[model samples]
Target: MDVPADDDPFEAQRERASNPMRRLFDEYGRERSGTFAVGVAASVFARVLDLLPPLMLGIAVDAIFLNESEFSLPLVPDRWLPTDPETQFWLVVGIVLFSFLGGAVLHWFRNWGWNRFAQYVQHAIRTDTYDAMQRLNMTFFADKQTGEMMSVLSNDVNRLERFLNDGLNSAFRLGVMVVGIAALLFWMNWQLAIVALLPVPLIALFTYQFVKTIQPKYADVRSTVGQVNSRLENNLGGIQVIKTSNTESYEADRVEEVSGDYFDANWGAIETRIKFFPGLRVLAGLGFALTFTIGGLWVFRGEGPWLFTGTLRPGEFVTFILYSQRFIWPMAQFGQIINMYQRAYASAARVFGLMDEDAGIEERPDAAELVVDDGRVDYDDVTFGYGDETILDGVSFTAEGGDTVALVGPTGAGKSTALKLLLRMYDVDDGAIRVDGQDVRDVTLASLRDTIGYVSQETFLFYGTVRENITYGAFEASDEDVVAAAKAAEAHEFVTNLPDGYDTMVGERGVKLSGGQRQRLAIARAMLRDPDILILDEATSDVDTETEMLIQRSLDRLTADRTTFVIAHRLSTVKDADQIVVLDDGEVVERGSHEDLLATDGLYASLWSVQAGEIDDLPAEFVERATDRGARAETDGATTDQ
Candidate 1:
């Protein structure tokens, strides 16, 4: 597995060590400030109200049944409010009921606030991440797998939502309960409160250790998830090949390998998590048991442990026991909070890291739209490479508006590289490509791409209706326009014969259609765009001879009065081209008309003679050179496989 240059999962631990919440809120939370504030306030108030029932129980135990009414409250005399035993009992009951009702109402508002916050943030982050991803340079995508990116957008983004909803909600609720109960215990009886709090440090230490151990494991979990997803996606995408090669068992074993890795990684994290929560429970149970033993001794045995006297009251003891019991979950939930945070922390690094990657290709700030009266394209001293290996060096050419310029070359001779440079798919390492005398780099990307139409050797069609795929780039095209373009590309007859005509669904990558049919649809798409400059890269290679003749006629009319650059291996396709440019080793070796190149009896002449099935008529050296070139192509392919 090659890690993307933009992402390092091992460093996720270091990144997660930073404040993920702060980074997330800074990037995505500020805009929802008002909503978030409301949600937090609601959670706080709800938790506070929830604590009232327990306190009311203590009040009832002390005042109504014991006939003591010993607790004090400011600004109210005992006689002013229910002083009779029966009235006092009913009053406490009413207050408890009211508190429950109030807590319920606040819980509803809290849920609304948090859910809305979570949903909005989820939608925003996913969309923003996708937008940022689409704007990145093609090289970034070339280095990263589609499934790996999808995992970030879908799984990783969903994880953030889970943390924001469940983790944050539980954290606030538990914090309020622990703090409010602690305060009440100390105020009631500081002597026993100290005993109750003895386990706090131990729990904290345990939780800290758990977090430290689990952080790296969670990061591994996230990485393994991406790998598993990548493997599944790769298998599905290449299912056709797998079936054709009868390698289903091999692919299944590959899937099992990645799936097992995911299972092992996830199980390790689960094992640590399982150990952590139970350990926390034991610590909490110990604290509860200790408080019960000492408090019970002070009351029952008439002796406080290492204290003045057994001054502990029955009512206060009940309150202490209830508060101690209540402390159990928050303590255990602390481990859960840490668990969710670590998972979210790992996910955030990959998501934000992708967002931080810079797009290498961008137009100048003051770039202007290209206005083309004539789509004259010029590639001047262009040089480019993938890393240190140059694909095209010092390559230059001119295609006057409306002229048909055919590019013919051997496999590694840079025909496709030159066209890609014209499209600005990559920036040239040296010199420039200009359209209508304006430097392409100085023009807005949208405008530069809008003027050129491309039909690739491998045509891609979306899984949609035929009409939709044809008008993908020109979405506003009416039925008449779509029909005209289809007719012009000689695709109308076969398309209308389909089960649903133009409305028929072309399955993924147009797998429902034959190769020739796909190519014709691609030609129709370019025709619909009506670009001033047209690029055809082996456009007719997939079609039969009759269909090729029909398409050639349509292309002849489509290329009229437009800047056309054609790349073809079949010499017949370029026979009528106004000028022919032959490339060898990334440099131009010949330039002339077809007949003139044939007259020169050079490389083009030998290739033309070979294509004409006149290999015996070619010179012995030319035949030897052709055979050597074929051998080199095979050797290069093998090297690439290695």
Candidate 2:
């Protein structure tokens, strides 16, 4: 099936900008009031400690060149240290040890605070995204593929995790390091500091240019990942079909095409990384060289005004150069961070897009609980459609409690569509459907669904034991209740015959079970729910004749004392219904008791004759009674003659 392109230009733009990395700072800023503030505090402390080494080096320079000058106090500037070299040496040693210990403590707290903040933010975003996924309506699922959804939940979310764990923390540490080093350099000699930072603006410009160039490539990579995921999902889902049709080569080729696209995308990103990282490294190297050459010349000549002022010294120059190199490392890393941010931004946009989808169907503010009193259902002039194509016209029907109404129609005749409406899978476009005198649209979805048991033609069972699948809906059901429901659905015998009895694993979607067995398990599941209303949609169409008979018997017992709605292609199934509805082209053409509809000799009668193999094949005694009723009706002139 060809997927339709999303037509909204705004939606396309939103998708393009959904990268996780682009929004990292926004994500962090949102938490700035709490843990982020703590992180900032710790980072400030860490940066303050980082400046100590350069200041200590400056003190050592003063101590060596002017021994008494280093020991001067604020109030007594002329006071000198003791003449004994040993006393001054021990004092300097004590100061050095204290500074080292302070730096260590600050470093520990900084790391602890920043890491905790990242974890908290990651948790919040992940929870919010997952919650949004759950709240999204069925239409979202209909439009998006399952594999794409999985990618958002798993891969995209994990990218954000990586950003938090490494990217954000790394950027924070680097920023602190750069600011601390810049402050130390300014304190040592403002002129030298200016020279060292001359290349910074150019480096920033290069970093921005590199990010701009790589953003599109990373976006392409993200798209390619989605495509590859979608292909894998399709192939895995249809593996059985491919094998049966001997289309392995065709499927493999398709997978390769998608995989190749992903490879090309990554290759482009790699090229960008290669070019940008090496260029940034060279720029950083040049900055380091310039800092060394200029600072060294100033120190050797001792003629630079800042050095002559006694504010700057030889050892201080050396330490400032070392600190400048430290600043350059983070400058180099800025390019890598930009790369990570762009990729993360691409992923974040996709995840946020999913999070932003509005559920088309939602409970009204005044929605009430479903009151299942005898399960009476009334469809009042209902109309529904998918997009522009109407699947059901202004159809109306009423089914009393304990009545079994069967809908017989050709494919696409709105039989299943009507059931979907009754189940509230989709709300009617025009009119309202009422259950127990309450409008379905005005009932809480959970209460409404709990009151109806629906069994579709395709039975879906989770990977679990027979008992678990059967008791899925009513988890608190007792062993006795489970056994009784299974027995009522004619599933207990087969289940007990399995190797593990009720504990036997069903595999994915009950692939371990035969078609009949899966259907029976589904029936048992619905039976356990014991809902007031039951919907059986083509319940026995896929089973063999023998299995159908067994299932029919089980269904007869299951439908008793409940409002049952059955959609079937075989007219025989509807023959015993209290009222049979024949639909065509989204309109109900005929409706009445079996005998009355057969007597009418209309669409329903024609379909019944064909399905029953002959008009006479329907019980001979019943046919005779129907003929007598028809003759009386004709004589009375109260009804039209067939």
Candidate 3:
């Protein structure tokens, strides 16, 4: 099978981005760009105004204790201010109250903008990821587990939202505080500012080292989360099987084993994260202590005429002390910001990576819709494979309009592969499959599938009422039409006898019903579709003999006016096919009617004899092949013995 890049959903993109997290933001954040800018601007203004209160307090101390001789405003000259000391104190107090009020208003705007932006991005990513997954070919799904995909869509995507809302907002808030405080401190006294900022470079280097070490550990943690989810999902889905096998303890041990692996992986990352914060606090503490000691000595000097000729007034020293105390938190918050970004980066790789995968089966831009008048299908020298192992080679066959063709072969003989080709589930490596002279690959996938109805050996029904399951493909079908299809499939009588009749809920995969009942509902679903081409891959194989006969009657009606292909193991099911094509090892080994091939005494004859319990009359070579195929099918759990 030609797998998609999403076989590993975290595969690198073709045009590798230097920063994937930034790319993700640009892609989904374009719609909310105005709101995002507003949020950031509000946070910046709030931090700037928040610094005003400390400056006002320092000025108030100078006016009250040192009097008008030492008190002097830079912007407001002595002529504009009140001469009384008490009036000056009240004027400064009012300005401080106004600053606090402005900060509160800006903080409100910041919360609204960031919260709305986070919600919109989360919804967009989840929907876009699901849409991409649905467009991929079946081979991609076969290579992945359901739980692994769910983990990316649910858990990983949610992580991105948390970072954008809380982490990114906090980062910007702390950034503004750090920058604003630094400028104010330097203006107060450059010498004291140097002491306060001395530890900043060291903190940055320490955070850089922590980020580099924790990144790979977080990647490992994400991978282990997927494994644990897969194991739990698999066990829950097959709980009935485990109970019947009496392996509850065995399954419990397996769950514990994966859970323990997740714990160890998470704990390893936790150890690295826990060590980072305390070390950051120590650096922040050093900056605080150094600034306090140096500024106190300068305050005692009264003018700093002796200490390097840089004079620091007592009021300015008070301002520097208050501002330096506020700087420590932003430095510590910077470390947390790095931790959140690393987590968001890993999740972005998986979510955006899935969205970047190429579709294996893509339609040409100019491909036209399929026009099926009589629904004739032809496989002209078709050859295909999964990886390097060929499944169908030089396989040629034809089914004329309104003809029934049956395919019979042993296990893994490419019987089902041939039917799937006509549906364009997997394109042929060579040659072509056509509907009414139009190549399948050349036609629109939707129109081609719309004209064909398929019922597989493994019947699957969704978790819904009988009416919903029957009308799944034909969503706009009327109640009368649904009843008509159910009656034709011989399912109406039993469906009406259930607890809620047609409204009864079928558990997941129709587990609430027996195999035969689920099989009948599947046929009803196909019958309601009413397509021009029908493919039945052992459609009645799951039912009992009596139910099979009932379904066979319905199949005859459904295939009366359509080109139908049947894949069967029981020779009795396809004895009346217009053409019978027998395959062995991906090649068309026998081609003829039932009676003509039986008279030829070839491989088809031997298979028919074995199913009919006439093995003694088979030739040595034919009997030996049949015996080998039967033993292999039994070991592989393939139901080909019948």
Winning model by lDDT? 3
Worst ten-residue run, lDDT, model 3?
A: 1-10
- lDDT (10s digit) by residue, model 2, range 1-642: 111234221145346454444465575547644666666676676666666655655556666555624443223344455555566556556756777788788767766766676667667767887898877665566656666667667777778767765776678778888887887678667887887888799899998888888877776776667778888998898889999999999999999987887798789889879998888878888888988887777767765644334445576676777788888878999888777777677777776676666666779999988998888999888898779878789888889999999987655668887887777777889988999889988999999999999998888999999999999989999999999999999999999999999999999888899999999989999999999999998889899999999899889999999999988878787789998888766888888898999899776776677676776555565466456756755775652111
Per-residue lDDT of candidate 1, residues 1-642 (tens digit)? 322323433243335335656778887888887777777888899988777777777777777777555643334586677657777778778878888899889998888888888888889999988998998877677766777889899998999999988898889889988998898888878889888898899999999999999987887778778788888999999999999999999999999988887788788889999999999999999988999999998878656766635477677788889887887668788899889998988888878877777777888999999999988889899998879878788988899889999999766778888888888888999999999889999999999889999987789999999999999989999999999999988899999999999999999999999988888888889999999999998888877998789878778877988999999889899988989999877788899899999899887888888788987888987777667878987876632100
| Residues forming the 10-long window of minimal summed lDDT in candidate 2 | 1-10
**1 or 2, greater by lDDT:** 1
Q: Of the candidates numbered 2 and 3, which has the greater lDDT value?
A: 3
Q: What is the C-alpha lDDT of each candidate?
A: 0.84, 0.77, 0.85
Which parts of model 2 are misplaced by more than 4 Å?
Answer: 1-38, 54-58, 61-124, 305-312, 605-642
RMSD each, Å: 3.1, 8.3, 3.8
From the highest TM-score down, the ranking of the candidates is: 1, 3, 2
- Residue pairs in steric clash, candidate 1? none
TM-score of 2: 0.85
lDDT (Cα, 0-100) at 631 in candidate 2: 75
The better candidate by TM-score, 1 or 2, is 1
